[model samples]
Target: MAVAPPTTSQNPLQLELQALKAQHPQYHVVIWATYGGSASLLPGARWIRRDTLSISTNRRNSWNFTYGTHLYDYYVIIEGKFEYHNKRMKAADYSSFVASTAGFDFGTKQSVMRPKPEFRADSWMKHLSDDLLRHGPLVLDKQLDDVLDDVKDFLEDNDREVVMVMLSFSSASAVYEAGKPWSEGYRIKYDEVPDHFNREFKKDMKKDKDLYTGKKWPRLGEVRGKVVICRGWDVDAEQDQWGLHCRLPKWEAAHGFTSNIKPSALAAHRWNELVGDFGKQDAPKSIVLAACLHHDPADEESWIPPLQTAPILQRKAEEHIRKSTKKTKHLWIYGDEMKKKTNMAIAKLNFLGSDDVDFTRPPPMTVKSAPVLLVATH
Candidate 1:
């Protein structure tokens, strides 16, 4: 799991998102924070390519439109880079409120200061209390409703490229908590237990054992409007560890990162993961493929490095596996040029090749490998 630090505006946008959830309780709003400045707070970032970009809400979420329930009022896309901070602190050990000592105060006839002299009682406990108390947990100057309104406008305005997806909390915890009905006070009430489980024991369990044949992955690759499958688990290239090569067996993952797994396992595994829409009735199996060039252990960038473009893509396109291509059960991304571009951290799925549509032809797994490339920003 690529656990990034909480972005700078996380708290503020979170508070605003909570308020928006309270207001709109009809659709499933999925907010996709791209690289930076989440759409819920910052405006004019992500956008959809269309004639006139405008907010469209479907009161009757249905299949006619093909868009999920109109479920999400829209897509909140934050298309910018991010600066992640690294902090390893446990809440259990830290004090919530620290009271600064007298050393911080400005008083007449104060004692002279020394390099490492500690005479005053006010040091760790009472240092910087004024700023800490004044600023609060996070900067909370903006109104929740106002922030949401800005998001709504940016999404509907249709001029910007960045857009936000607005939906009902009926889908996720954030929305549900934000939209909880409140009469007297803002603290709304909610029933966390899923609604589908009521009035039945284990009856609600799936009847088909093979309902989801493939694994649930952390990363997803969309190819020609379908889901693309990639690597498997079991990084160790050992005989005993080779069993994870099966697609369905190693599908349960947080990120689409299975490159390090043994080749033997990959041999047995057909698909790396499932995506684009799994359970939908009319969902298609369209998949795309890409390769992260630096996946090789010898590649210095594989561990500690910055972004740079070289012959990596060409190298990838030239040597894509073919035996894997013959069994095109799903989209196979093997071209050497399909190098790792994005490192969203769901395992090794960093390649975001150019969005080239190949509905008529299959990927390099069969014979000719298609080259798609994405630039690594950070």
Candidate 2:
């Protein structure tokens, strides 16, 4: 008696097994196992008992076995006692065991699959850092906007009655290169300075279209009136020479330091001028200075301390308004200390308030001890 060949009308399991084999021609045998055990059968059997079995025929197809408990009981024999005894072995382990018993070889041991690129934390960090480095200016501008927003929130939190907003730069020539004067005497006149600054500011703003369009100034609720001043002065006397006549004299006098002054003194002078511009009626209770100071790369001996400048400037501002009835409740300095390079060195100060100083006494003056020249010895 001869047996008939398997046809489409065969049992569903056999047909499915045949299709699986046909789908993965590389896989010689696909061992499908089902655990036939109950939770009540053993004390800790549930811990090892998996709801479904995991099997990968190839890289593309992963098979999950979820047939009824008795489907392969006769052949596989993984019933109550058998399942409890072999609970430690997983579905893949069982497949390997059966394959080894029948003298078949699967590949090396399986490894835990890695997460997708988007799901990885380090990938997100790398992407953000790369984007920031690529678009440095735009990212810095957005950060400035965020800083301004925080300043606005801070002012609101304090419930300041009168607010003053001032933006001052130590060296305007550093930022607006085209606006710098040709020579010392031929410097751009004070009258032409505003036009030059406006032109340069507009040009720079136009360069990046995605810059923050919102109001850079903070808006206070209770204040009847506010003073907002944005001014930039040239500090590089050797390069532009305009700063010598334009604002350097005033800066030197107000700075109270020697002619050869540090960037911190220049910054302090600028802050004093910003605060002194307003009269008694509009004197501010809270002051905000967004100061931009230039760091000379040639002078390696001197380092720009972005942290200390705010307090020094605040002291100068307090002294300037000492006689007035209005006292400074808050003074925030958001400083950007930039060096002469392709990329700017940004230093940010967030919500730094002023320190109380005894202004009735005279301001401390630094006495620069002159070098004593010894006469030619006898």
Candidate 3:
């Protein structure tokens, strides 16, 4: 008889769930169904018991249980094979039920689901190692290549010329270096052309040869498109490793622009300048593609409000392209802090269509009269 592969009694996922519950006693941990092997391993976990309870009843009872008390601040939903009316309940249904019971408005709370680990710990670690290796510069290069390929296809399909502009901070030196090898692409210095409209400088740029290939830079009128990379001005690459230390005053001064001039205006001005330099009468319908980082400062000392430049640039580009054959698109990659800052900045703009879309506003505060610990098990 063939022997089956040996299996361990301990499940990695169960251990994670147990640790999560232990670390956060304030959260209400709910397992949707009782069928999963790991569900019973979680201590102090609540069972939905969908076989015996309806979602509406659960909602009503949960509210009644905590109506006059403060039971849990948040709900952490765990997945299991749940069924209702002989139909399998989806993970989304569990999330929706929890959201409704917790009185969480749509999009207020993000789901906290962990990725399923491999059966063996070693296998899981190897998978994680591979994932880490695939990220960073390699992944960024692939992403840029994909975007450029798509843009090229679009240009061919539409018979249009485009100018792809990439804006990054001095901190993203790796990304800047990775993009340096693209054909007809060049990095622009902060003070190279103080006056972009200067005829002499424009003429000089047309005659400039690539230091590597000895090929003259493509004039906007001669080619389908060109890539221009712009780095944050006056930011020390050595000091600001992540481009988080950029000061607004220094940035404005570097560009010789007045204080408080929006970064979006500067970006638009650059785009127009590029268009004017390369634009031909026959190719009036030009496309602009911008990619930039959205940085949110970690402290007051390092705060850079101009990091919220992406959305304003988008709005300005949209307005400029309206009723014209020109097209514009932008991509902003941000982290958790960046997301919060950008949302707050956008909220302050007050240009959003609906009051319901307030991102910076917090939910109404309530008083906690009593504490409740309601833990159910299979």
TM-score of each: 0.24, 0.25, 0.21
Candidate 2 lDDT, tens digit per residue, 181-200? 31211111122245366446
Error of 1 at 168 (Å): 11
Per-residue CA lDDT of candidate 1, range 1-378, in tens? 001112335465445444434543321222223222333334222111122213333444322222222111121211122222213322221221111112221110111111122323232323222211111111122443444344344435433222211111111111112243311112212334344432231232123221111223211121111111221222233421211122211111112334354323332232233232122222112222221111222233331111221123222322332212322222222211111222111111112222222312222121112122111100
Comparing candidate 2 with candidate 3, which one achieves the higher TM-score? 2
True-structure lDDT of candidate 3 = 0.27
Q: Which pairs of residues collide in candidate 3?
A: none
Query: TM-score rank, highest first?
Result: 2, 1, 3
Clashing pairs in 2: none
Please give the distance, in angstroms, between residue 332's alpha carbon in candidate 3 and its true position after superposition.
13
Locate the minimum summed-lDDT window of 10 residues in model 2.
Answer: 342-351
Worst 10 residues of 3 by lDDT: 103-112
Better structure of 1 and 3 per TM-score: 1
